[model samples]
Target: MVSKKVTVKNPTGLHLRPAGILCNEAMKYQSQITFVYDGGMANAKSVLSVLGACVKCGNEIELTCEGVDEQEALDHLVAAIDSGLGE
Candidate 1:
């Protein structure tokens, strides 16, 4: 398993668009991707799951990936989030 802490940089938070982008990115890997936020964990490959977390801008999340490509998945996700998830 691999994990990293990242803060949401999108001004609007993980709204529909960013959430979708996150889910899309997550789907690119075979690893199980999830994020811990607000004392809860949400599947990164599911838009609904991410949106339901209500992660706002500046909120910190611990992204975790476990599977064959865990490291790569974690790296990609952390970079994506760091880049504002294409916001």
Candidate 2:
């Protein structure tokens, strides 16, 4: 497993649109991905779970990935987050 923490840079944070995009990207991989924030964890492949986390701009988020392609998954996700969650 691999994990990294990033700050949410988007003003809207992980809402439906951005969160949905994240879920979509995560589902494309055959890896186990999860987002951790506020002492809670959510599946990165679930839009509802991500939105339910109530993340906002400037919040710190930790991404944990485990599987055959963990590194690639992490790299993609880190890029996504760095892109302001595609905002």
Candidate 3:
């Protein structure tokens, strides 16, 4: 398992567009991608789950990936989030 802390940088947070982007990114890998925010855990590959977390801009989340490609998944996800998830 691999995990990294990242802050949501997009102004609108994980709304529909950004959340959809996040989910699409997560679906590329076989690893299980998830994030913990506000005491709740969300499946990164699921747009509804991410949106349900209500992660606002500036909120910190611990992204986790576990599976055969955990490291790569973690790195890619962290980078995506760092890049503002395409804003």
TM-score (all chains, Cα) for each model: 0.97, 0.96, 0.97
Hey, what RMSD does candidate 3 come out at? 0.6
Model 3 ranges with Cα > 4 A deviation: none
Residue by residue across 1-87, what tens digits does model 2's lDDT show? Answer: 999999999898998999988999899899999989996999999998999999999999899999999999999999998987668
Q: What is the C-alpha lDDT of each candidate?
A: 0.95, 0.92, 0.93
Question: Which residue window of length 10 is worst by lDDT in model 3?
Answer: 78-87
When superposed on Cα atoms, how far off is each prediction in RMSD? 0.6, 0.7, 0.6
lDDT of 3 by residue, 17-85 (tens): 999989999999999999999979999999899999999999999999999999999999889989988
Candidate 3 residue 68 Cα shift, in angstroms, is 0.4
Q: Give the residue spans of candidate 2 off by over 4 A.
A: none
lDDT of 2 at 79: 94
The alpha-carbon lDDT assigned to residue 18 of candidate 1 equals: 92
